[model samples]
Target: MFGPWWKLGVDTTLLAFEAQAVIGLRLAKLAAGGSAAQVEAQRMVSEKVLAAGEAAMQIATGASTGAVVAGYRRKVLANHRRLSRAPKGAAKP
Candidate 1:
């Protein structure tokens, strides 16, 4: 049950990490070809924005995965309960 969720979480984290790395590379490009001072300032701002974006992505991904797992568990449990309560050795009308 939880195995699938763990796998999904790991895959999500990896994807997010890759996306952040791509963004970091693009930011580096954008921060390039400027006066030393200007480049430094822009680099600082880019770093902050990139960090914030990565953090937000992680949080959102985690929350969404948790919600999906919770919903699935709830559904499975409900079905199990329903089956447990069903009469045995009876024919359907």
Candidate 2:
């Protein structure tokens, strides 16, 4: 902890992760043996996926995504509501 005062403020974890990811993507691209256009397309797709993940993170922090979850939950509750009040093989008089 006493090595350097400046080192404590800087965390290299994310920088390391990005470096490793670049290496991994390079290896994957080489293994694919595709044309330049295909490699470019793959790169674009990966970037888009990263953007989507970022958006999901933003949605997680915001209050709007809850509405989508609530809509699905409401449908599930509607489906089960009738079953709770009625028994199978029983008929109304």
Candidate 3:
């Protein structure tokens, strides 16, 4: 049925909104200043670029919107877990 596709569309929209909010918060934190703020900003840019490239490749290979979005959600959650466990001022290499 069309129900699944409709759900996927809604989920994708929600994901996009969540990602933007998180990115905005990160930018605000960076602007507020910290020893590792510069590194965090650079990491954010690199991560987004890499994720976009991967998503584009997946779409080119005929992956569904749901699949691409799920992948993004997984990556974002993993990064959140990793960052949460790290020391406050530590920057990952």
Q: Compared with the true structure, what per-residue lDDT tens digits does model 2 show for residues 1-93?
A: 654433422323333444455555545555666584376467656765765675577577784543434433443344334323534566966
- TM-score of candidate 2 relative to the true fold: 0.28
Candidate 1's C-alpha runs over 4 A off are 33-93
CA displacement after TM-score superposition, residue 72 of candidate 2 (Å): 27
> Model 3 over residues 1-93: C-alpha lDDT tens digits?
999899898888877876776676676668867766787888888999999999999999999888999989877766655554656677887
Candidate 3 residue runs with Cα over 4 Å from true position: 79-93
Off by over 4 Å in 2: 1-34, 63-93
For candidate 2, what's the RMSD? 18.7
Better by lDDT, candidate 3 or 2: 3
State the C-alpha lDDT per candidate.
0.55, 0.49, 0.79
Ranking by TM-score: 3, 1, 2
* TM per prediction: 0.33, 0.28, 0.72
